[model samples]
Target: MIRHATTADFEFIFELYMHPAINPWLLYEPMDAVHFQPIFQELLERKVLYVFEVAEIPVGMCKLVPEEHRSAHVLYVGGIGIHPSFAGNGYGVQLMEAIKLFADAEGYRRLELSVAAINEKAMHVYEKAGFLKEGILRKYTYQKAEDRYLDEVMMSCLL
Candidate 1:
């Protein structure tokens, strides 16, 4: 099941956010309870975060942020991640489809997102969901462990 996230799911979401396997691709540092509490509270209030549940267990999440600086007709997918245990089970595609449908219903003209250049799996998933490679942002994000920069590939889909 896919549904808007609630404050009650914060613990599970935080666990996933701090998962070691996900650290490398994350743009922000791992969250402690102090950091995540307020964010999860805001997410519940804003209703912009969605989670995928398998038999009532959270498996993945997608967060969307409206493009306020530009036109309201565009929505940006801020983040999408699935638990490593669920990676090969097609949950990512299901989550993408849900996002696309939600965007269409909300009258968004386009959906935009960025993926780390080295994340081939996520790029493939986005491409399969009808997002096209738009461009690249050089040194877009900082890689903490490597102490270097990483490129981000911009992608978009016309809803």
Candidate 2:
């Protein structure tokens, strides 16, 4: 089930974001609770954070930012990750489906997201979800820790 995340899911959220296998793919670096709390709180306040649960156990999450600007009628997906234990269990697909339904219901005519070009696994999932490659964003995301830039693939699906 995909539902709005709540403060009660903090431990699961923190653990997932801090997981070595997942953190690098996330939008932000894993910080100690002192720094992470405020960012988490802000996301909650924005109401864009969602939790994916299996058998009522939190296993993953995704953040969708709605954009209704004149040039874009889309929902931007970010901070998507599935716990390592839950990977390849179809939970990711379930999460994508839920996001699609939510976007459609909310009148978003397009869904947009970006993935690092190196992340082939995620690119396959996005394609399966009906998003087409828009273009490559050269040096779009900077990894401060790595002190290097990564190419990003911009993708979108028309609802």
RMSD of each: 1.9, 1.3
Query: lDDT tens string, model 2, 89-153?
Result: 87777788878998898888888999999988888888888889999999988878788899999
- Which candidate has the highest lDDT of all? 2
How many clashes show up in model 2?
0
Q: What is candidate 1's local distance difference test score?
A: 0.84
Top candidate when judged by TM-score against the true structure = 2
- The reply for model 1, stretches above 4 Å from the true place, is 54-56
- How does each model score on lDDT? 0.84, 0.87
Model 1 weakest 10-residue run by lDDT: 22-31
Residue by residue across 14-95, what tens digits does model 1's lDDT show? 8777788876776557768888788778777988888888788788987887877567899989658899988898888878
User: Which residue pairs show collisions in model 2?
Assistant: none
The list of candidate 2 runs beyond 4 A from truth reads none
